[model samples]
Target: MELHILIKGERDISGQIYTQIYEAIESGRLVQDQQIPPSRLLAKQLGVARKSVADAYNRLTYDKKIVGYVGRGTFVSGAAAAPTLPHIEAGKAVMGSLKKWGEHADMTPLETAYRCAVDFAGGEPSAHHFYQDEWRSCVLHGLRQCTAKRGKYGETAGVKQLREALIRHAAFSRGVIATPEQMVITNGAQQALDLIGRIVIEPGTCVAMEEPGYPGARLLFTSLGARVVGVRVDSEGIDVDAIPEQAKLIYVTPAHQFPLGMPMSEARRQALLEKANRIGAIIIEDDYDSEFRYSGQVTNSLQSMDKFGVVVFVGTMSKVMFPEMRIGYLIAPPAIAKAAVMVKRLTDWHSNTMVQYALAKFIADGNLLRHVRRVQTIYAQRREKIQAVFGTALAQWFELLPTNAGFHMVALAKRDINIGELIARARADNIGLYSLRDFYYEAAPPAGLFLGYGSVDANAIEPALIEVRNILRAMLWQQKT
Candidate 1:
């Protein structure tokens, strides 16, 4: 190892070397068990006599700071305690320039506790039912294949086999038709949104989305300096006529709108496509958590109905499998898809190749479908339990939103109630509840609770809701008095 010891002026050579080495050890620059350069070589490099280097080594060994072996030369015995440096506060000017949208952004989603006896955290899936053995087999196959191949950076668009598998899966399941070339694999739906934002949004670009939409998408657009317009959403999903005429991009969670849990109506979907075509705006369809629909007629995706090539459909495996898998894809028109590929290359090159390969095999081997079917049954039972409880016990205080798809449902407060206080009280009782206020960007969001059935098991749902009903009744009575 090369030691950066500076011996300047007419100081005692031996003492200077000793002090420098000691300081290096004390500062943790010289770690324990690290071999030092030979005394002869160090002396030659430092332009000092062998005696000076020898004296320094002798002192360090005597003090037990280092150990010299017969043939092993010298090695640091142990690391010294690191010295504390003077703290330097960031200057106001520097701090001011670093202020971004995230600095003042709503942090409710991140701050909310996830673990509880009854968790209603939206977008979370039950990992307890995952097919561990099947997934392990697929992963081992991918690993073996990857080990045999040349280790280099894969394509930015992602593994070709996975794209092909997604094409088949999307076509068979969501009615979205796209070739492998039109898709770009991302880390997750969030990364897909970020890539789209990077390619489409410039400073002051007009972007329109649902009023109470996904916070992740809203925060992404805001951080990019886009002029975001919040379009009002009804029971039929985002109101098409409310969107600005000059919007370059319109983000929508059409399969099941975030927080509110309503699918976009057929009439609204057609009108939205017409409006986007007339205005030359691109639409981002985030089809998150549409795989497990419990009731009502299943609706085709906006991308499947799109004739003008204005829709970019984004989907994720996080809801179907798990969030930590971090795999999602976007299907776009050739022009936008090509640009998205380039943007993805610039962002992080590509996602995990092994996972992608494993997922491709998983999908091809029918394990993915089987897993979704298994979990769908579990989630449907929980959803039913939630609906039954709400109908019987809590119907007076909360109005359940009409929802057929997705793992979560929203219930609006029937009477005036402090949502913030309710959530705090619920937390105190070991019940995790999430509010809808953070989903709204520019509109007065309704007072509601997003009840998710993904994390909480079927057996626990009724008990949790029973307790929630008692609490709600008490709060309502207190408010009246």
Candidate 2:
């Protein structure tokens, strides 16, 4: 039973789980009448979420290759024959390529907020958004619909209602106006990035990204073999003047630059759009955390300002809603949407339509909007609490950057402290502080650590910073010795 499941360079859990099971059956490794491992056991073996394994099993059952009876275990169907195998040595030859990816497996480190040690980290939203009654109710409603359409391949363009609701929501919230037909639902913003890269990026194409930008975006573009060019960002967000006119695409977090916490000013936004028009470059506007703005009205998204249809606006529910939701959308220009949809159709088909339908009902009913407002009020208070902590002891050691928006805050470490040593010591204190170098390419590593404030409770701020300050003190002592 020489069975190996391979998902090459993809972070998708759903496919990995399903593919492993499929490969085992197809390669005569999992014979007909063989009892498949229970979902929990397989999930543990693969180091994946249990929900994913169960979903894969359910998919297999729908295909009639596996079946189950009440009070009995699941088994491969008798009608299904074990697939014939190639010569043993021929199979062994491909093993190296399969094992090569094991080193790059994306097992994200445990974020430190669970320990209540770190005060500033990236990607933390206030806990008010978590376990909210409305969100749970929405999930329940979503579940009810899933049971109705349990075994169906979802619509390739996503559920129509969800697409329509997204159009209304975007116009009202982000100022992007588009027909429902012009948007494509995705598993998340990450998938949207991947799909866009697949459609546009060929080997060696130059893609411009903001320096000190979202690490995920940079990683995605680079993974596609695009030579990533970093454009400098400033108080007004990505510097349009700094971007080379010849680049094929530019990725920017204009609403609130990741980690930098700066909004692209009107002039700069216009300038970038104008430049994009002149150079025929595509602008990827990531409005990931804009829904949680602490003060003032949420600015119009770049998609809304695009007269030339050059902006590809990306949004996600991971930050504003929940990470597990895995729902995001790309608001593309009509032409790009047509191209992206063709690519998406040949790929995963579409994101879970049941979930999309439920989200549609959630948005159309005004529950999502109401929930966003409620969470915004609570995060506003938490933001103030975090700011107060930074003003005291931490301020003496690091300079706090201007933060007009987003969940994370940036701190410029004083030169006297060794940033890397401070990070290692801080982690030992159970504090999770990330450095800017983690987000940069090897040729150029940016300085500083990203501190996510959203995940930290308001009450825990002082204690977390105390641990961080003590760690810095210890690092200073080590340097003196």
Distance from true location, Cα of 130 in model 2, Å: 3.5
Instruction: List per-prediction Cα lDDT, in the order shown.
Output: 0.88, 0.76
Which tens-of-lDDT digit does each residue in 104-216 have in candidate 2? 24422334435534446667555555446655677688788788888887777778888898888878877888888888999899988988888879888889998877667
Best by lDDT: 1
How many steric overlaps are in each model, in order?
Answer: 0, 10
The superposed Cα distance between candidate 1 and the true structure at residue 265, in angstroms, equals: 1.2
Residues 1-481 of candidate 1 have per-residue lDDT tens digits of 5689999976799899988888788778888888888889999999989889999999988888889899878999866766445699778877864666347454425755347777788888998999999899999988976886657888899899999999999998899989999999999999999889998899999999898888788878888889899999988889898899889999998888887888899999999999999999999999999999888888989999999999999999999999999999999999999999998898899999899999999999999899989999998899889889889898888888888888999888888878888888887888888887878878888898878889897888888888888788788789779
The residue-level lDDT of candidate 1 at 261 comes to: 86
| TM-score per model over all chains | 0.85, 0.76
Candidate 2 local distance difference test against the native: 0.76
